[model samples]
Target: MAMRKFLINFNYLNNYKNQAVRFLTTASTLSKNSEVLNETATELVKSIVEEYENKGKMFTLPWVDQHAINSALYPFKELLNLGIQPEFLEDACLHEEKLFRSMIKNGQSIYKMLTIFVENFIMNYEDSIRMFAKWCDLLENETPQSIQSRINLFSGRGLASGIGLRRIFEKCPELLFGSEVQKMDICLEQISNFFESGDLKTIVNNTPHICLLDPTELESKYEYIYFHMGFVSEELAKSKCWMDLDLFSIIDRHSLLLKTGKYFYPDPKRPQLKKENPSPELIFDTPENKFANLVAEVEYEEWLIFRELCEQQRRLEDKQEPYEKIKPSQRKAFERRLKEKRENMEGEIE
Candidate 1:
């Protein structure tokens, strides 16, 4: 354990025999001269080895040989010099030299990201690598202010803080590296305009990856669901996962429900999917085989075909109308006749 502590102060691994001799001599004196010190030394030794192994297991690649170590020497030394832990280097880093080589040429971004992983979120080295590789492009453009905001954004939020950034990265890596910072600001504006101020945090808590969604597409979906369908922003915020679903799928399903007469809502009062609403899971989540019965289908494929037909009908409807505008007199007459028909049916029931 004393030897390992010496390692933090000195590069003894290259000439470990010399360091080992000194440590062993000290151990020998401690064992014979003081039994209590010897027992304390043993516990310390076990803790040192456990700490090393903890980080060593961070990444595992199939190849482990001297050659791998030889190739990784540059990065290993470079990271070590930068105060990075030795166990952070995975086997892949040793086998694949290009990662460090590229990093060496433009080490700033990589180093900055590494520090964030190590310090901010308490992420392992592998977690840093997964996120860095995906966002290296955009991260290169990130100012220090933007980087700090990014840190606070994930680490300070409620559910987002608990889940960390990995799930959002898995859901949408593009937000990290693919888009511009200005574009993200635009997206934020659209979200704020559509929903209440606090609802922004609510949406992120429900689905962090929604932050990366295209602003225009987000506006379209929000307008349809909130304005056209009469769903409020708060309801949408609770099920922000819906924003991640395919746009075409949402529209096609709505059309299918309308055709089936299972959807009934008058125009003055737009329908909403709320906590009180009784609807199938299809609207809230991507339907799987487990929910094949939601659409009265035996298989998911059949449900897909049903959506395709709805799409075809929708396209035909779009082509036929400049606007689906009806004359006021004609609309009123049709409503009156529909009311009479409903009244007659009620009379028959009576």
Candidate 2:
């Protein structure tokens, strides 16, 4: 009976020891988690303060689940290694798995660019997924090198190239996914005719997506600008202010100048219709109100008149029978007929 009792007491002691160890381990784990969460909260509050100051739209890691944090500490370390500011680091750590998978699919260069793209915006999990989806869609049938090259080209040209590659794609999807890159080439050639020297390279530098227009439609707009308004190729090229103007917009806006005698050529020597005499940037680069105040009174007034003229011009263009652009050959034919009529009149007089 004594030996059996001793064995039972030994067994009880062993079980107690095991329970004590487990309890200590559990307590240690909880303490570590509490520490991590507290730190995360402190950093998040600091980031929120920075956001209020406009330092950046601060994004903090979510600690609501607590389970994700215990899953792995490597993501938190990875976020640190990336040299991302604390403002963005926590959320980045939280989404580390998703970000890593996306990087694998998109390649490092594109992935890095995307991170830069979203670094400025404050986004939630869903926003991140949607942006990621957009990137995946853009990556289809497009090489990273090609996208980088275009980005470099636009950036070098002094345009808002770095605003975001996705933004540029959003505005003009055809440049990437469209089947007809050749059509844009034709558009460029047609638009080139309006420039005196037709420095298409320069034009592209100024406005990268201008070639998205249809060639013939761009042609009609250019003809009206040149012949009807008396703007020379070099003058138009110099300003490029009207590059994005719709059909008859130039005429409609500038007509007020002709009507009011405020119209004057940008060039003093070869006088024609008024020119903004500034970079093409003045039209789209600056805020309308800001740019308007800086330009000539006539230019500002012309801008104000544009909204009214736009509807009128659209109505007239709509009324035309199958609206065809008159080619140079057709213009020449009309000129020849006029000359023949003049000769016959001279003969009748004799």
TM-score of each: 0.55, 0.42
Clashing pairs in 1: none
Q: What would the per-residue lDDT of candidate 2 be over residues 272-295, giving only the tens digit for each residue?
A: 424433333343244545554553
The parts of candidate 2 lying over 4 Å away from their true place are: 1-99, 106-137, 140-179, 196-198, 264-350
Q: Please give, for residues 1-350, the per-residue lDDT of candidate 1 as tens digits.
A: 45455344334333333345553566664454333222322333233334445657332322355454333233334455444444344333343334434344345556666666556556765666655655555565554456656545555544355245545545655555545556566677677788786777677655656777787777766655553334566666767456876666555655555444444333333334233342423455645444445643346787678877867777787755322333435665554564566457659879
* Every candidate's lDDT: 0.52, 0.48
Looking at model 2, the pairs that clash are: none
- Pick the lDDT winner: 1
Evaluate residue 312 in candidate 2 and report its C-alpha lDDT on the 0 to 100 scale. Answer: 68
| Stretch of 10 with least lDDT, candidate 2 | 75-84
